[model samples]
Target: MPTITKSNIDYDKRNLSDKALLKLYYNMLKPRLIEEKMLILLRQGKISKWFSGIGQEAISVGVTMALKPSEYILPMHRNLGVFTTREIPLHRLFCQWQGKASGFTKGRDRSFHFGTQDYNIVGMISHLGPQLGVADGIALANLLKKNGQVTAVFTGEGGTSEGDFHEALNVASVWQLPVIFCIENNGYGLSTPTNEQYHCKHLADRGKGYGMDSFILDGNNIIETYSKVKKLAESIRKRPRPILIEFKTFRRRGHEEASGTKYVPQELMSEWEAKDPIENFRSYLFSKKILSAEIEDQYTSEIKAEIDAALDSAYAEENIIPNETIELNDVYKQFEYQDIKPNSNVKELRLIDAISEGLRQSMEKHKDLVIMGQDIAEYGGVFKITEGFVEQFGKGRVRNTPICESAIVEVGMGLSIAGMKSVVEMQFSDFVTSGFNPIVNYLAKSHYRWEQNADVVVRMPCGAGVAAGPFHSQTNEAWFTKTPGLKVVYPAFPYDAKGLLATAINDPNPVLFFEHKALYRSIRQDVPTDYFTLPFGQAALLTEGESVSIITYGAGVHWALEVLENNSDISADLIDLRTLQPLDKEAIINSVKKTGKAIILQEDSLFGGIASDISAMLMEECFEHLDAPVKRVASMETPIPFIGQLEDQYLAKGKFESALRDLLSY
Candidate 1:
């Protein structure tokens, strides 16, 4: 329970023991030399590219040593020293850079974009700042479990400018999570200097606004860096709270091997060179007599020899056949249905009520389930979908969040990684654009990238009819369906909404669940009270006919049904595609083959929409059986107008009947 302060241990005194000092020194040395070796390989054309962490070894080594190896770390590209300190086999590291089959990601990714489940380290993507929020999620998970584990996340000074950085800090501060947000302030964001990047003097000062404990440390000084980080890490583990530390460091090499340092002034480069992190550490160790010149020379030779051997071994390995693992991690790796007793007496419920019931039942079933969104708890969201949720499930379980879209998904990814099922509400589907990076880049590809299942259900209330206008009325299911790894479900009726949401929450991967705003109060159906799950990638045959196959989902299903009801002559087969990504291609093909005609309808834009993909698929499969070309009826390529009459005109109101009539006649 003791805290480290200047009053107790002298600032100049050697805090770490001789053995610990040597370990820290070696941690810094190994990655510095490994980078040099990689640069050599880059020049020799053995590796495609390299991002050298030449002068930033102190921060990486210092932080890694501060935390226990059991704790999780979300490291950026430059933190190769983290891998080395964890004693990741040198061959595995080399194999990753060599793009060999034996690598962590099996040659799927390059540089430090690989993670080993055994080490509890999740490697970063090219999009740098989102990991901070993911780290916050991991920390939140630990706090919830009372595990006393902390998460250390790394980013550059440039990354602080990103919205994810601020969002993550705010969440960590509000929730009092055990996370350390380490910023490596090397004075430049790739090419842009610090002055142009932010008006604030110090990056660490930004954390004060979030009410987090912030510090500025000399990144080149090993003793100072180690002492401060070690204390902060210890304190946060006991009393969970975020700590922001800005390490004033330098990257001695180019951003990449090909990018020269011509943009930087000669004086700046020379100044950083003289105060090199690794060299400065060596001088400190020599001053303490922990490492002599003789030992240093012997150690360098040994490290160089080890790296060379590892590179040689990596080069000898075969390249991974990318096609062999092409199908792997594309969607939920595996899924299983929950056994529930079917209700003999079904109860009729509205779409919104059914969704809330599904959430309540899911939370009751799984203790690790957590609900997160803006106004979702007290106000029951903008639509009261989660009405009375907080009373049933305590505020801790049914939580309200700050208006942070990107962090919402990013935090969900982290919580999912830490074995928590997160049900996130986006208030409105149109606002999903604000938080699209984590969903598209991080959450969608998580399973594929690292076999990390983001057990997250992102509830998006979508579509028009309520006259919410451009920002609120947009149906963005097509955007997510286009993404490979995410399972997109846009249900029409109350039964499908309840069942699909349950299935989505219990599924092993990330799912984007879209509920039409118009259907919330309009539709009512007999939904089973007992826990029931609907399978993904399957379509519901609402009304079967022979003339044409009407394929649609969400609000489009109702529109198609209305057309079918009004016209008795035209017998159309109404098919609702419940799931989008794992699309029911067989059903569509069968329907088109039987009817000899097809119509793909949706509320999204005409160009580059879900109908487009369906049309392409139908053409490939049922092209020979079709009597005429496929017809797609969708909203025009313009913003949804604020005026109801104008919106109807833009949507081509009552056009589905005409489109179907034309297709049937052809």
Candidate 2:
């Protein structure tokens, strides 16, 4: 509705000299050269992947130049120009392209991804969106550290559609976070043009709806891009709210090395090229007589030599890609999961109570921990996992928020990214669909991208059986179990909950801890009052059996235990997959081998469930140990019905019974 002009911005009055002009131009040229070399590397098949920021260099360089090394940045994939301003080694860029060890983060920060801890910059990009949450987090951390630094996060025109984009902006606006959101709106989201998909003509228009001060500028025009963004960056740095500047530019190349970019119209391409920011800036400098033609040539030659030398040194010194051995490393916390026998004090209690007790205990132990959710603070959460927490911890620590699922997760990731160990208590697990944009695109891939974990725990009450109806009850873990950079811990018992929750807090990864609403108050077991922890990425054998291996976790572990206890004919071994991603392959394979049958059980649908992924992992890694086709016991491939009988019937895990019968027959 309204735009803050340069005069209105506080930094507008700040003077810019010719020296400042030269530095900005140099940054643009340096990145442009490095990106071009990366393209050559990509085309020649030297690099596996490349996402170029050739045309949209103005915004990247502009905003980054404005930020100090103390001020952090959470850049998306297309912000190479910013990386140049941060002084990321050029050879490291090349080594990253070549997948060499000497590359950024020693091969961890691969193509289209880069991070250096030296600049106080924590980089994160799902290559999707939601990185703004990360920016808010880094900014929050800067605040905690009392560092007078602003956090700038970058995005694209297509990113505006994501729920996390809105979540981040809204959270920052509300909290007055020192964040500058730079959206490089290069028109097309891969193949879909913004004009064709979205109703808004200007991408920045969406930011205003979130109450963020938003602006749209020519991303290719260096002078305007820098002037506009620098002002906003400086303003946010001073007051620390949110301001989104949509840099309108065009991708000089395809979305990635694999993309051909044939979808872009010739007219749009030619028009954007005609207004190239780098060329425009160069012209501006030449016309001002700031630098002679000889000086310009030397400048280009100097940057090119720097790139070549960096590449040579990087290639000669070391490779970039992380050692293949680390594939299983960093995937999960290395905590050793042990069966801590229950003491006399650890009396059997229902599961929901046990989980609640664990939450209370963990919160008591860790003062830095903050618990937030819809009804969690005063209402004790929907499942009451946080019951009495507000009474015990008070409003500051045991907090409540507005009904914003995306905002909830954005806050969690932000707090976690900062320094506070915050857990988001979702009323029902099914509502995760509302916040899926931020969770999957940002939280899921955050650590892998930044090499820093956003240690936020999303405590959602999931699963069926309570028949809370379709909207209230659904197992949504299947949506994210396949994601790499996350920890999904579904504990079946109070002991497991306490141990795992403790483990989750200690973990340097984002964890989705599903406390089944069905089991919360109903189930009980002897849980230790003493301090205990359970490491993720490991499974446990509840019972030893020779007939079949019942592979499950969370509530399914209890169900498998029941089936095994009742029917002794088919002695089933229960293996609880404690952590979904780092998946306890060693435990799973060992159990499957010992008992040559697998019946993976979960409350999710049989189709496209965690069982499929778990079974595939077994087949690929320990396939030879199988005695029969790996089976899956899950709910019917439909939403949980409202009726009780229908719910019970639909909740059937065919594999648990059928697989047992088959094993018995064998």
Candidate 3:
């Protein structure tokens, strides 16, 4: 706990080769000079913006040196120095800052989020804390590969406040994933200082709540930072697990390219300014006689010249993506969203059977597809959706993951990032309530932030039937669709599940596939053997008669189908909206226009049902198309009851048929 001002290297225990020490000391300066070079660019107006990681170079450089190219490092935007150590070319780094495609990761990624696939660094996420989720996932993938790889995620003190940070730590601890959450506490989160943000004093203390080994390190001391992380990393390699390190340091510069650090206390800045990690490390090297004055000056001068030359070259390079790079390698093409082709000759299939079959075919079609969940392999899931899947596909293909819900989601997401198509099953759809973090933060927003796509499909069992009370059953599609980056689907029949699951797997986004456990075995129908596909936004007009159009999907689709069959003359078109985000609003409006009336239905409680969103949309787009006020049929606003009879009443108890009858009276 001593304040890390300066420390001498112990040559006795680890005889320092002057050459090795020179390299380490040299690396420390390269990243520093790069930061200073960035400031020159900022001043010259060559670079519109940049952030400088001046004080924290010791830890970032030390950690970068410890890497094995196969290990993943989630770096912060400010840590531009670490990118070079990971073998990211200096000119490319400069080009990225100057808005050129020649930059580290091409123009697709922000200059700050430069990633090198060659160094096994999965792309950097510019957003704050969520990279820890990706880090946990990367560790999970490395463990699965038995590749002795590690993922070190760098975040700031402000990141600990995000839900993703807590959720990631919890999962990494449970699964013992080889992830290290490095917190660079430089006092402020874009001007809101950490001291003013939280009651939890040290960021490291937050990890203990999730049962992780929390380490507080003096980020400015290379000797301490390197030695401590060396052992921690060794322990992780032995048997991967998550760790949190709080690097108590302060920023020498501002947050980002245009940050105004005027509010920073001058005294506080002066206190940390003297112990600048690079300068301290240089002094330590000189004290040990490891670097002669001539060599020290020579290396510093050479490094500064190299940085200046790289920046100059980067400034002169063209900013546009090269014609060759437009489709270069296309190894990234290995991972993509599969669009479900709309089928004109598609037949009906059972939801579970269709989904399971789709899983099998997807595994057959794509070598990278991995299916996992509690009881999914041998038992074919709780609903027997995956029954006999383990026998047909090997254990690795249809995996029986441990009972760690968040880990399952994160591991699957991690695999997806590593160019794999992963299908994760929820034992009961209710279990999805536990793993929402990775879904929303890492999976959902990945495409938007970095144009990074994850083809991870989650088969969520939803709705209430067969007496699955509160804990066993629930419809939470509303929770998913509320987020803009996710694709939510609730297939009423097996055929829709088959087609939509195929679409979901092919989709360039995170898809929440809701398959009602109640309807899994309750009904059976003729499913297609060949030529199968379903349009996401296209709604099915079941027994269309035209007094009212009822929009619903999933279990409610069954009820609407039944109502259509029972009262054919009453004439209500049942529109099964397979895709929620794309929503097929055009179809709904057309149905409402033809029928001149509308009703939306859902199995979730009426209070926060998706029907509300639809009702609001209809009022905005199609108020004139309505013959009567748009209506909604949803479960009553109560937690599902224990009694089967009560559950039926609590849920949508033939409510659609009655609503249809009332609408026909319109």
The lDDT per prediction is 0.85, 0.73, 0.74
TM-score attained by model 1: 0.96
Residue-wise C-alpha lDDT for candidate 2, range 1-666, written one tens digit per residue: 112122211122136788888888888988888888878876777668888787788888887777776667777777887777888777666766676766654455565555566765555555445567767656655555556677777777777777667767776776667788888777788888877767977777877687878887777766667777666767666676777888778887888868977887898788777777677677666655664677778889999899889878866874334456676565543444454443456767677776777777778777778777786778887666678888788876776666678766766776665667878877788888777777776676555554545668888788777767888878788777777677788887777887888777767567888887777777776777766777777777778878778888777877777777777776767787777766787888888888877778888888888888878877886678777877777888788888888888788543467666765565
Q: List residue ranges in candidate 3 displaced over 4 A.
A: 1-16, 36-52, 87-119, 122-129, 146-148, 155-275, 288-350, 375-380, 388-404, 469-472, 528-535, 605-629, 637-654
How would you encode candidate 3's per-residue C-alpha lDDT over 617-648 as one tens digit per residue? 88888888777888888998888887878987
Instruction: Tell me the tens digit of each residue's lDDT in model 1 across 400-426.
Output: 899998887888888888889899999
lDDT for 65 (candidate 1): 86
Candidate order by TM-score, decreasing, is 1, 2, 3
Each candidate: RMSD to true structure? Answer: 4.0, 5.9, 6.2
Candidates ranked by lDDT: 1, 3, 2
Q: Show the lowest summed lDDT stretch of 10 residues, model 2.
A: 1-10
Better of 1 and 3 by lDDT: 1
Off by over 4 Å in 1: 1-11, 328-331, 337-341
Ten contiguous residues with the weakest lDDT in model 1: 1-10
